[model samples]
Target: MKAARIYLSVLCLSLGFLFGFSPAEKKSKATWIWQSEIIGQDKQQVLEFCEQNEINLIYLRIDMNKPSDYYRSFIREATAQGIEVHAVAGHPAWAFTSNQKRMMNIVGWVKKYNLESEPNERIRGIQLDIEPYLLPQWETERDRVIREWQANVEAFTEAVRDETGLMSSVALAFWLDDIPTPDNPDMPLSKWMIDQFDTICIMAYRDRLNGSNGILSLIEQEMQEADELGRRVLVAVNLKKDMNDHASFAEEGVVEMNRQLALLPEHLEQHPSYGGIAIHDYRNWKEAAADMPPVDRDHYKGTYIWRAETIRTEKDEILAFAKENDVNLLYVRIDMQQPLSMYQDFVREAKAAGIEVHAMGGHPIWALTESRGKILKLVNWVKAYNQEVSSGEQFHGVHLDIEPYVMPVWREKKEAVLRQWMGNIEAFVEATKHETNLEVSVDLAAWLDKTPTPGQPDKPFAHWMMEQMDHTTLMAFRDQAEGIIGLVENQMKYAQSIDKKLVVAVETKESHEGDFITFYEEGRGEMNRQLQLVTKALEGYSSFMGQAIHAYEYWKNGKE
Candidate 1:
């Protein structure tokens, strides 16, 4: 029988946590969709700009025929920042045939975003995008009859949504002749088209519409017609050039931009079904940040705690690790003594490794012992740690890794010092708790297991270090193998009794000792076997859900 590895992704319901269906292709809230459309800067930096501005919605343009890694970082960054993204693809209406290959691609996207699962699945819905402006030059070549196109749209939507539960929407030219428009005689077919979608975005700009009709007026009219059919409306107002060969909002027509924006709320009031707006391009909206509100400082302020530098190395390494280990939960460290600027190499490494790292903050021995004159610098270190964790993707959670040390004779005095030390630590944890939903975990001293105490309902750490983390590990190694196993098992049971998560940590340093150590050194079997066994052993004791290896370097070296 195959043994399942302990992992959070497996147990947690695969809900729509990332992408969703929307008529508009918006990159972020800071994006005004009025001017500019090119995202050439660092992906993380642009994403940070969004977080700081409290922008959660984003639209990414990807080729339906070709796939690339450019969107990988965008998706990762969006997931980390809790931003929801929708994908828009450009293809001729002819490409969406009722064939099996196209059917498979649609299903693949649904699974990739995990939209077919329970709860807030990654994708809220899919878009049946028909950019009429990009239509074939000859009207005869393009299928103008909305009925023919509607059949394929509904087929593709059903195939993808039946498995993923993603809602569906469509984008179409706002010509009075479009399918949902009541006056259109060619396809007065509202039932067939409207039934397949949760919403429809009237592309109320471009061509004669942009020149003759104001955007707000078009939105009001389409929304009224959509509501009459009991369908939701998503307004696609233009932020760029129009059908009249006029310049985009940025290049030539800057003055009338804000005037157009002021009409959005009024249009919504006029036609309440307006779901939201989708900007033309991501790069354009990001460039317009200069005219928006001040960047939000608190949004990106926090600390990251990592488990290894290897998870920070390269994409192949990260992906290989995930595939080999059947897990993607990566740990990264954020040292409070080191400035966040110094961790770029680590962050880049992790990003390359495809590892989503969080941070852990604490001072080095040197900084903690420095004179009082360095107090302000010390405070800045704390603040910067906060900012980086709150902003950085490679850094996932706030981890405090201060080795709990006390000589056997000075144990009492050390405990008092720990209490005093934790005073600042407590403030840091509490401060972080209020800011982000990122999970918080800590590495505590082994001595917390010397005597176990009961944890309160909400306060698990009341008895030990587990209180400080959403889940925490007791680095148990260097002792006898059986003893090490026993300690971890006990913690798991106790934590489970209190309804808290317990992480079983295995040190690679210990795996290097004894018989298994010699086998590990000789490469007799898979290093993953050790990982699998420990995970199985813990599962034998309590509700074991996940396992965290000690260090990336040690694991890479095949050490126990």
Candidate 2:
């Protein structure tokens, strides 16, 4: 057992929480389908559509012939933003193949893909759509056809459990509940699906829910059975236009469809298995829903994750607080020995909450002398961990907190140490990009703008760092709002031109350096007031990503 050694407690369900909040869970809010047609097209549009709609899951049609890297890249990027991708594929015949060979092949393929993938480049789960209803004599010979279909599902599920190590989901029609199995005559076919698979997606398909056979009534039994089984049901609506208009939202337009979809939670969320709703395909959804709202801010408004408390905390509580406070990013250190399962859970929760977890740890010495080897090891660790965990559970990026100026080498030769620091950061970024596709960020002292480079005496060191790195945090560790603003004001002014994202961070951790160095004594309430002031002051710069608290321990301690 690998023990995760850390000064702080670290557990997250997604985005890999930095500080030590212990637990978090997500109720699937939104989901969508991708029918593989958008594979080569403008994929960015689909991602944007999901982001805007707050879609938490995607059922992507698995084109088996497609290269592993192709799926890896898309799934990796999708998961980083909190959208999970499950490989969905099935022809009615696939379920009937000799020995369930087709299902075995898919499992083998995903296994190989996982073996080869960089961390974050793996699929979340397996969702299959083996629609036996499409067979030639479905209307004439329904009973036998349903039983055969049920047998196929059993075989496929067995293979998934024995070989793939992935959660299983089966696409189902709302009326599947009408058919019951021989062994369990009382159990509905829909209930059997829920009982057998990790998740069941009821293709409700209808745009309305008022009367009998409408969306709600169709899935009522599935939801009830799922709740009893301690499983989940994903309600799927249609965007496919050629299908029945009552089933597809296409004819209703975006606004009316959204109104109906919103009522799902109103009626069904009371059930334990009410995971969320999923639309048929992204392309159709995007084309038809032109009036959906746009995402507001896409920058860093984060906090320092710390774990300096005697009492434990709930991650759900912390996440709730984060949402209310507009904290979307978290910076924390990584303990290499951490259990892979723990990080996987953290990343999932964080992504669902739309919070970024940047792995935050670096000593000045790690950058100062002969540190390239150390840097490589660190990058490798992130790569290993990211690869080891489930898709969204991987770290969002690296937040290197290497303050070289605080070292003795900086005192002896300030510019040389700064140059070494910049070189180390550059190398880390290069290696991280090569090893893992996660975003790279570093912490900088605010005064770097005033401190000129060693050889180029006229050019500020901050400019060089800015050119080398795009996402950065300025350690404007002042207690007062004015002091914080004054320190990072120049960076705020110049960051736009350099095309960099700068997070202005203040200290809340208790510091022996100076009383004015931190707001730990002032408390979280006071820190919030000062941070609000800083936000107001820097409202002028669109490049001002936002502010960050030093660490969770001090922040939480202040609350106490």
Candidate 3:
């Protein structure tokens, strides 16, 4: 009976191959290792995590700076465990015509690395995670951005065409199915991508397995497209805690996540295109599985320093005043032309004294669409500065004080200005998203709570702004606690609903606007007293992050 069974199996396999049918394919269970540096730091821990989780494939982010030996060791060990490691690299900017070279650089590097490495240690494939939809231009210039993105994709495909056995893949958003292809409007962008790449990892980041908006439903179209094209598709889920409840399994815990994931093979095995599941990243998965404690949010007592030179000239006085006033956060203005050493010293001292310093810059014109380069310049400067500085000397966040309302164009083109402002904010967030340690914040006027968003009238513009940022400082500018609380009541409710942070701000500059707008005449004693009342009033609101004073110069010169 055993001999007959073996004979039958061999015969069936041979006949299937001859008849253009393939035997049962092994589905790949994959995950992404975004922090490539982790392999150098803790390779064993990463391997053990993958081994324990039964992961057979890893899309390891390539850090070109790291020596090839690190990747060789990791890939060799991974291959020994029946796992295949693919090189992963990308950035949103790479979708632009000017940045296509950056995308190709990854291809060039991976090709070189594979050539130098042993067969078992070689990278099995390459995956691009570039999502051009995150760009601000995607909203205002959708057609142009799409064309450029298509060109980039074509360039990428052509670049890798000759690299044999290097399976090409891309991590794409599921909604691309709704977008028509640039050249052929009849076909969906998702289908175009499916045809271009060997495998498509659809980021179907829903938490549940079933429902109209669940993981299975979201990837249905992509799966069908991939099936028709005879390509593989991996359903990717986010494990990051910051995503919305439906977008991640962060709150559901590993056991529940696994329970839902185990159902995938049963439902998807019928489709030959279903390649298996890919988690968003390694660090978040490990941390979530370990049930790590949440970081504490200390109340922010922040003040803005408009002059970059103040940090160098008044370092002693600033430190003394901050110590006396219990100030924990400072938004210091950045002078791009100044040497980074000046700020580094101040930041290091401030950090040692338990005060976090954020790089601050903005102008009224920055909100204009034409001024996007300026924003990118600042973002790039901060990123570069951070790279050059030590941890203790690095800026903790970025604060934008771009008051578009101050521009004359705001009065003439209110809607246009609002649209442009929104785009700039999107650009800022996209540029900063990868900086995991840097927080993004903006100064919002209190009256914005009453203004309706340009297209989203059901929600206030303030709510939309708060939703984009990690935290916002409401320029309530009221002298009394009740008045300040009243100005930000709607924002507080919205912030609490979204689980975002809000910081109430008071003015110290002697305002030509109104007496109630500033604490300049009220003296430091009265200002402190009023702030205490405001803190007490807002204590019950979970979104209340504490208070901020307007300007450092004015606050220091205010009445004693």
> Per-model C-alpha lDDT, please?
0.47, 0.72, 0.83
Winner on lDDT (2 vs 3): 3
- Give the winner by lDDT: 1 or 3: 3
Question: How well does each candidate superpose onto the true structure, as a TM-score?
Answer: 0.42, 0.59, 0.49
Q: In candidate 2, what are the lDDT values of residues 467-519, reduced to their tens digit?
A: 76757789998889989988988887788887777888888777899978999
For residue 275, model 2's alpha carbon misses the true position, in angstroms, by 15
Cα lDDT tens digits, model 3, 1-560, are 11135643454344334433333445577888888889878989988988766688999989899899978988899899889999888888888899988889988998898899899998878898889888999899888888888899988877787835688999999999999987689999999988999999999988898999998888889999999999999989888875478888888866567656755765786788997788877888998878843323547898999999988889889988988887889999888666665776688667656677999989999989999878766765666566554454578888899988987888899889999999999999887665445899999999998878899988889999999999999999889888998998777888999999999999999989889889988978999998899888887889999889988899999998
Q: lDDT for model 3, on a 0 to 1 scale?
A: 0.83
lDDT of candidate 1?
0.47
Candidate 2 TM-score to native = 0.59
Clashing pairs in 3: none
Is candidate 2 or 3 superior in TM-score?
2
Over 4 Å off in model 1, which ranges?
1-319, 335-356, 362-394, 406-412, 451-462, 478-481, 510-527, 540-543
TM-score of 1: 0.42
Q: Give the best candidate by lDDT.
A: 3
